[model samples]
Target chain A: MATTSIARPQAGVRPEGGGLLHRLFGRQPAGYLFLLPWLVGFLGLTLGPALASLYLSFTDYNLLESPNWVGAANYVRIATADPRFVAAMRVTLLYVVLSVPLKLVFALLVAMAFNRGLKGLPLYRAIFYLPSLLGSSVAIAVLWRQLFAGDGLVNMALWQLFGIEGPSWISNPRYSLYTLVILSVWQFGSPMIIFLAGLRQIPVDMYEAANLDGASKMRQFFKITLPLLTPVIFFNAVIQTIDAFKAFTPAFIISDGQGGPVNSTLFYTLYLYQEGFGFFRMGYASALAWILVVIIGAFTAFSFLSARYWVHYDE
Target chain B: MTSSAAAIPAIHQPAERRALWRSILIHALLIGASILMLYPLLWMLSGSVRPQDEIFGSSSLLPSSISFDGFVRGWSGLQVSFGKFFLNSLIIAVLATIGNVVGCSITAFAFARLDFRGRNFWFALMLGTLMLPYHVTLIPQYILFLQIGWVNTFLPLIVPKYLATDAFFIFLMVQFFRGIPRELDEAAMMDGCSPWRIYWKIMLPLSLPVLATAAIFSFIWTWDDFFGPLIYLNDINTYTIQLGLRSFVDSTGQSDWSGLFAMSTLSLIPVFLFFLFFQRLLIEGIATTGLKR
Candidate 1:
């Protein structure tokens, strides 16, 4: 996606003076040296591990064994036998489908509301954004569990007011997933802030003109604001979908690393966590990882391919 | 577009009942929405401080009497120490910021300014890699660290940051670098200043806003990261604050409600302070990233 984003600018370019070494080393090797730390990390950390994982996916390498090649066996087992993998996939898909749209709409509404006048707007911005800061913290996830716990806050409120019982929300398989959905929605600040910027970019002059023409606020928003904001909306949709799929901390922390309450909250990344670190099924985990990469890649490509109709950019 | 005079006969003053009531209604609705946005956080803060017995008592959003023991008890657990975990977070956060700011800027400089072979291909590769979810590579990466005997150490936590493994910062820096005029680099070069000198003397100084943006982001993300530390730091001795909080969950099959709640309150302080300190930049950076071309 980023490659295609950059492709337009690269072409026959002007050459620098002297030689490659001279350009690199001329007055100072300072830039290269400045980048030394990260360069070391890339060579030693990222690229090295990335390739290692690809190789590990083909080997039956539990921690106890020296990785023996077992071509496609890990893939076959995952595809054929793993009920948990299917469950995790279902949970993750539900999570992404439910959370991303809700988050986008909430963000859009908050952004629209924030775009207009409000006294102490910065304070409102800070308050709305606090959840994103708290997000994925074990503390927050723990708090979420409590908030939804049967005898906890949510139930206590319900029982007190309505004289009715509330089920074990976080522990009940029926409602456990709501906690994850709520967690994602609560952290809507990033997208909300993005939407706010997108809102600001829609020319105020257009709204002013629409008002002059006697268009109702409802009509103006639908006809003018929404159309122009499609690009930003598209961007948020793609990014949020990717983020929703990769969400781990809250699920792992909330489910107590068990994928729990009958695997109701067995999010994909959490399941990946289980296979890799918990069970030490490193090979299976790597296969899971590659599948995730492919899934994310395909969806990202899909969004970009579709974006030409929506995302507007000025030259 | 209709003329202002024709659309609103009276431009400066409010119309009688029509506009006035609607404006009042909208503002009231906005305030109601804002209150809803805030209620959850308000409840969490109150719950973290309430006595264990009183916690579920009436689901109070605000405690009648604020107790301080939660903060005290939360801050006091574990031999590894919250202060040490704090320092660990501090060291990792600060170093990661430095790595991101300096390293990403230099690389961004290469992508935005230099005319090197494979530059476009490499930039494209870097961007393409952004879509690669880290979960797939996580286990193998952990194993590599385990093999290298770097697990249970801060190296795994803090080292990859030194390498431009974080693509977003690099992309952000590249955009900022692109926004900067190339004449500055050319003028410096004409004076026999090397490309490296040009970056330091010219680019770095000018890119302060974007660099601060990158640094602030890296700090927040690193401070909050749990997955990285969860996998790498097996020993409680080397745990960062986030890892320390995970221990609050307790493995004895019984949740320590009071202690955990107390610790949650305590865990929030540094993060709260960090957020407050950089609030302006935090909003500005996020808002700017959204407004990207």
Candidate 2:
């Protein structure tokens, strides 16, 4: 950022350009014109609500009645006394750690396989990508429920092959969490597609040179491919982490919206949702929502800081 | 169907005698992985038609007997008619798509091409919004709608879309517009075309491929969004398909598994058919959009 400014301005190429300065500083109305819609929404909708929500967080505002400010009571209650919040935080943290890493690994592996010279590659790409298309589908969630049922196909097949019995994966606290993780891994298609596109950008000459030097495929991938793919991988990592935190629908549906069977799959958003919407603890829910925002913001900042170590953007 | 042969295991074409086993080994691994991935979806389809009480008891890939009752029940049994639910989804999705393609393209063109004031600051603000976690604003937006008495109507869903609630679409369109040569806009303006006319005549037509991509993504997004509809619409009569699906589970004691799966399969029909019909456009759009980026 610093180098570009010195070089470009010295070359007499202003970032704002020459002699149309009225428009440049937003001195004129045109600046406001382009932002009219969003400005209205931000001020009238986003800002007002945002402030109200922050205020509401300090109070006990159920939807039906006026809020009574409880100072830091809600926070104290949630942090120390609320067992559900602890359970939810534990489940949510485990889910994020397991699913995000697994999905990234699977995505990279599938992307590498597709990047090679394969027959009917586009067809392969499309088929592999179909899971992402079906990712949030209500049908897929419903299907997942039955597939892991006590006497469902999974167990029936298990009986035939190994004569083993299967537990109700969705209902059993032990297995429900695994089911969510696997479901997340199934939707690894988007990151895979992104990786495939990123892979294609890497010049084939790099690989050819590596191969001719008696490097094995594995060595070429680690040395040449991994370094070049770092930026794309980091981008996917951040996006997937944020997404993992917000993952609600699948867990909601599979758990039958109760987040139950011993609160094993009681994801953070689910509890926040139940509190805010189901119980009408609107104020408490808002506090929960803002805490999430803070957590997400902190993680995003941490990832950006951590990127200097691993992320290799060409610029 | 034709690809099933390739998925079969334990058999492989021989290479030179020494390398034959290695070739077979690779094929075996590849085929095994493909089947493991594909089996769940195939089972889901089969389970959807399996008769009640027998859905779980069966061990076979194919159902012992098929019944359309599940589809019938799923379609007819909801608090809101599934037809109305589908229509509600269709309306929101179509309107959202139209707003995205038309509105975002025009805005993107203005930002990329026109010598507009405050453009950079406003553009920066637009980009910054993309980073804002949506839930931070979700409650307030709900309150705003509730105060305005627009909660139950589709207005909450459709109106803001036209007002450009989504910045991703706008940014995507901006990238495409920036890639186009500036000469066309200049030529159109030289021919005495107004800026809006230039946008319509030159940019819009040239951006059809991207417009299609924006439209299709908007459709898919709005169709799948349960949260938006669930928040805005209180009355059961106004429920979208996703809302109906969730409520169906809530309202029932014993879930009609076959019916649920049947509806799911049938619902896929529209999206599947849409993709089948526009696959050429979809892929070309996706591939080029990714490449140009």
Candidate 3:
């Protein structure tokens, strides 16, 4: 939503010309009245807690006693000694790097396919979008664990068709993160819909011109479609990267909430959960949370900064 | 039948054939992809109904003999019945959805139509919250709720909604509200209607589509939420469907695969039904805001 100026009574003037209270409070008591709920929420739920967490990140509080300030001790320990923190960072980075691009590419390809005036477009879209709707649900996460088990459907097909055995993917450290990656890719529908919307906004005359110039379909896609679609791509990239970093349920469910099998699927959020709730190391978890915020902030900032070079905008 | 006419038809035949072939190929590709995408879900459905011995025995979708034994066992297999879990989920989802719609609409009206001191500052702050990861505040909020003796209650899950903590819905509504011509509010004001009357009588009624979008999404999100319940709701009696499902796995420990599958299938039914009924609104909502889920 754009933040455009709205009609307002002039400062120091009241429409009804009331007492001193009207001028002191400005001419829009009704505005603050309507904004009361959100103001309360922002202060109470978001801003207050956020600042509290930042303070707690520098202290040691296990919920049993008052927080004792450690002054960067927690951050030092994480950077130097904590193996699980390192593992979590490695796993989460791998997941973000592997998942976001693959998901976006798949979304773009499917969006392109659907943009060709395909028959049954709605049906195809609904089918594709179903997974994303159900993706974060524990039910789907449960189903995912089964699908990658040793005697699961994947291995069953492998043995029956190709005469090869497959690993119990979720239990294998080598393949566990890959299963989560595939799961992330499977829910590519949301980005696809956004991409489709972006695709529709591209003028058809551009395609007609390319067609008349003897451009091949592949050339037209790389030359016209990709450039025009960069804004949507950037949007999807940032959103999906942030989402992937925060991914929890699949790793939690599939790992039996342990982030096990050598901690391969120990996502940063999972590790934070383990520290915060599981172990009651509230201070450590607060530190972890702030680190995640910085990481995500850096990513978003990087995307926005890099966008100027590659993300084409008409305006 | 001149030679030129014969050549024209001949030239058109191969092109038409090629177009037909391309369409067939595209349809085949799409159909293949769709089936692959749907196969796991279909498998889960079939697995729930099939005989226990046949679940891991074959990868085929068809079950030679089907039974509802899984549903029968899974429904009451837990300490608390699945029905109770469903009711708990329904209550939380409904309450959360109502809170989000009502709270977000009024807040949006203020941001969209009203003018106040520090309006720009607050509005920018509100947008900034959209980018802040929930984890940053989650621990402190958990601690706050714990201090208030709301650790295991649905209040921890649903109360923030009433306070308009979900800024996405407010943003969505603000966008939608901006599209409704300010003339409607101006016309109502000319009748000496207060801003409250304008918001109540004019803005909201015109915002049904966006409201429905917010409602459907909030309901689905609340229903699908696992972390909230996992963190705050510890009692089995108070557990939502998501917690129930996860506990079903933990308690069953691979002994009741079919039961797990059965309840999993049951848990997805509400979300699936919502999608089937409101697919267009849901898709358009995502497209408009680029919101994931």
Candidate 4:
């Protein structure tokens, strides 16, 4: 369908019967005209800045002074000497490793449950999706801090229900990052919705066949549903992983924009913000940014490569 | 079901009873989970109305005695009123939505309908930009804006939308516009209508669903954005609600819990309202493309 729609224009181009130069520049000026805003933005905002940042990454530019070229010094320092860089990487990696799988698991479970021909499915789905809508807001981040405070609701519930004392989870470095992990998991609604859509696409006759063959629900799920859902699972996994890497607001707000509680919540983006805007280390921040780009690019490449081994396609 | 049940009453009775029990169990579990998910927001809402002394150490969603004191205090808690922050956020979000809808749809129209040289190449490039992270471009864009003296103004936040920098919307609109049949454009062209007129009169009307989806998302994202406004709009008078809420955290410092809750609840109202009014569209958008808020 996509290919046909994209190729339809080719026939239109041939029918115009213009010379190559005329076809390129004269025949359909309206196409370029309509695309003007996006073209300008792509060049100025995205491509230009990307190249400029790559150049800045090799320099020692501070905001007040003109850039002084330093030829990979920033990358070398990051590779060797920067302790906070290591810490930030550790925090971000742990976050990505922990949050993505947990969120996906929760999302898959809830989606499967919802997919079971339940009554009031729309109401249930909306209730589940509310968090994903509101979770990234500053209000939610603030509410999270209060929820995990020593005297806050979680501790209060712990004491009242179980007679156990709960520490301030947000302020305890030992547990601070875990709070953020839980927060990430709490917003599993978006992935759950995607999974629901994917599950809906699976043919029901397959399930009926399994049931007639004396297979239990568990066996059918494992043998049929899991195999068919791999593509959606892979999609959710990659998108969630990239998003987890770029997570900034909750950590920044929760840690008071310092990534504190002994740097436990020092998300990579938060650290980048600190370096760029806090210390005015524009060059160092650009280096950090490029490293992030490399890490994300590498991860995306790895995922696409590995997807061939696991991702199931009907074709 | 009744005819089969009558033929095998003994077997059917147990199965029916078991199914009922299972249904009950599932509903019970779902309702329990729903409560767990909504508890925190309800908590904040309740906290906002409670008196100051009663705000902490209470997990109940009921206020001891409802009071407007928190709202009054929070509205004027900082140097600039929360109303100003809200107005700032609204201006930015509304302008961004208009810019995105107008800018992206036209770009998508060209890509999906027009026959142009290098169309496929440019389309591929546009899709590639969808995956690129904003961090790499952050510093240099900031430098560009700073050099042009766009810093400390809303220009940095709003101008990019008019230039259609958000490739996600463009990609989304492209997918939608492609689904629009070419026969309609051909028919319109036979009547001597220009492409622009056809887009304005036919495509835009037919594509309201996608446009609304893009507009709603654009508004919500711009309203919820913190980093852009945080870096660009430093002045207190120019802060968005996210920045205002952050500064409220900084200035209050446990001095006013109820006030903080009040403002936080207020900050989420616009987004919550959007969700309520556009629930179906939002869900369909995410289901189709996995759009993030």
Candidate 3 clashing pairs, residues 3+ apart or interchain:
none
lDDT of 1 by residue, A203-311 (tens): 8899999999999999998898888888888988988898889888877777788878999999998888888888898888898998888888889888898888776
A1-315: candidate 4 lDDT, tens digit per residue: 222223233323223535675456544556787889999999999999999999999999999999999999999999999999999999999999999999999999999988878999999999999999999889999999999988889999999899999999999999999999999999999999999999999999989888889999889989989999999999999999999999999999999999989999999999999999999999999999999999999999999999999889974
Q: Candidate 1, residues B152-242: lDDT per residue as tens digits?
A: 8888777677677888888888988888887776655655566666778889999888888787777778888889888888887788888
Q: Assess every candidate by TM-score.
A: 0.90, 0.88, 0.96, 0.96
**What TM-score would you give candidate 3 relative to the actual structure?**
0.96
Of the true interface contacts, each candidate retains a share of 0.45, 0.27, 0.72, 0.72
Off by over 4 Å in 2: A1-35, B1-27, B253-255, B278-293
Indicate whether candidate 1 or candidate 4 has the larger TM-score.
4
Estimate, for each residue in A158-229, the C-alpha lDDT of model 2 and write its tens digit. Answer: 988999988888899988988989988887767777787788889999888887898997898889899999
Ranking by TM-score: 3, 4, 1, 2
TM-score of chain A of 1: 0.89
Q: Give candidate 4's error at residue A41 in angstroms.
A: 0.5
Model 1: per-residue Cα lDDT at residue B229: 87
Top DockQ prediction, candidate number: 3
Give the lowest summed-lDDT range of ten residues in model 1 chain A: A4-13
- Show pairs that collide, candidate 2: B70-B259
Local accuracy of candidate 3 as per-residue lDDT tens digits, B97-144: 999999999999999987666788899999999999999999999999
CAPRI accuracy category, model 2: acceptable
Best by lDDT: 3
